[model samples]
Target: MIHLKKIKIVETSEGYGEEVLKKGFEFECGHVNLMVGDQGCGKSTLLRMISNNSKHLEITLADHVITKGIQSYYFDTEKDNPRVKDPQMYTSLSGKDEGIGYVGALTSRFRSHGEIMENMILDPLKDAKDCVVILDEPESGLSIKNQFRLIKEISAAVERGCQFFIATHCYPLIEAYDVMSLEHWKTMKGEDFIKLAREKRYDGTEKDNSD
Candidate 1:
């Protein structure tokens, strides 16, 4: 089981220079910890820092080494500047690159993305010690069938004692994975946010418009 014991970011120069609070949240062993928040509540920010990369945030881990050991993966839906990047605070944190051992999953909207994640990554890494995965909206472009497959893959990985750090707005994830809703996870929860994610799962788009 891999759990986060601490994450304290004081003054990270890697991200936009702003006074960031020293923050840390703990998780249970080998569980898929989902973060649901509004578009700008820093859910992604918190995930990245947990993944060992947060710009301008000072991060200090209670356990640099875990019982399973220390490795991580990331699948960023928005894998570009301003959205995802190596936290500049790297230099100040430990004087060593925290992202060094992490495996960053490919960011693409291709139909085979789910397959790639299952076959190419999770299958191989699940047995390895210290492996963590960060899935950011893994279902963005997948069809309903494919989305189900992704869920299966994630569930399987979690069963094998692999820790997961995920950021997503997908409703299926919220329900299927039983991920906590944004209202529950984030301080800001609205009817619209919940409705949108729910609709995505049932595909309430056309119905909503017609009504």
Candidate 2:
């Protein structure tokens, strides 16, 4: 029901300018969007920008976030120490329009992937309002059944007023969360390198294979 309303990007040197990306280069979106990539693109960067802003505005390229991640994360640990604040996540225009549920980490709950996706992840949020949920490479840890369950969860979330912005290099995830694939995100983190992203998320004429 509610949208981000205004999405303005700030200027950065040697990259797409804010005006051009919003008005021209980038096909802008809101709470629910999907991003795909080949190897190295700016997908993660965009997600970080979106998620970092806690004003009912969310952008996520990864599976999860740690709140003000730039200053809060020090090698996967907290610095400023911001935990999952549910109301804050749902205080935006988007949240009021949708009945959203905000939970903390999905990493600490289950022992198996299936249990994690169904019971821990999807089951809990099935009734929550979710105009969007930004997820990073969810396929990295899930099984095929788990992935399918994830798809079910996403579909349910969308039907309930939630959208998603997911970042992934996995084929199954791409197919599962196939509503959109803006592009890939490229960045090196802790000796690892990510490749190009698809929409500025992956852009292609191919339709997603999932229902």
Candidate 3:
């Protein structure tokens, strides 16, 4: 399990004021923790703050810090750019004549979006234990069917003791796991507010906003 006491952010972009999460939030590992919110609601920022590989943000993992000796992988689809344009180039780069072997099998050597995700991001870490996987909108180019498939893959990883911190707006993906809704992070007036609510299970019904 991992606990975060607080997270503070100072906006250095000229003219933008400071924003701080004075109270912070906490969530347990060993299960998928989904973060859902509107754009600019700080979902990605919070993920960055908790990530071990983040360069700009400073984070302190308080009690039950399991990050030490744990292999962490962060997959940001927006910034992913494969140098090889085709399967032949990939084969040459990888030094393999056939398809790129992944997840204990051979997959397409072509550089399609979904294939890229499986080959570069998901397949390598699916069976890992005691690791932390952070994905920022991994459902970018996948179809609805593929999104659900990805969810099942992640669930399997979670069952194997791998922790996942996912930042996404996909409704089906959000419904498929334990979720921490960041809806209360902002108000109609556009100010920072702390409302951390954890839903241990999603019942396939509409989200409850009574809190």
- Tens digits of lDDT, candidate 3, 1-211: 3333333342222221114332334333325767666566567766766674433334445445534445566656665424333333222212234333352232333456676665655555555555567788888767787788788887777676566778876667765555555655422211111122233235524446688
Candidate 1 runs further than 4 Å off: 5-30, 53-68, 80-130, 178-211
lDDT of 1 by residue, 78-117 (tens): 4521114453312111123333112332232232545443
Residue 166 displacement in candidate 2 (angstroms) = 1.0
Q: Model-by-model lDDT, in order?
A: 0.50, 0.41, 0.54
Model 3 misplacement above 4 A = 1-30, 52-68, 83-110, 186-211
Judged by lDDT, which candidate is best? Answer: 3
- Which scores better on TM-score, 1 or 3? 3
RMSD (CA, Å), each prediction = 9.2, 12.2, 9.2
Comparing 1 and 2 by lDDT, which wins?
Answer: 1
Among residues 3 or more apart in sequence or in different chains, the pairs in candidate 1 whose N, CA or C atoms overlap within 3 Å are: 9-58, 10-58, 12-56, 14-88, 14-89, 15-55, 15-56, 68-130, 69-130, 71-130
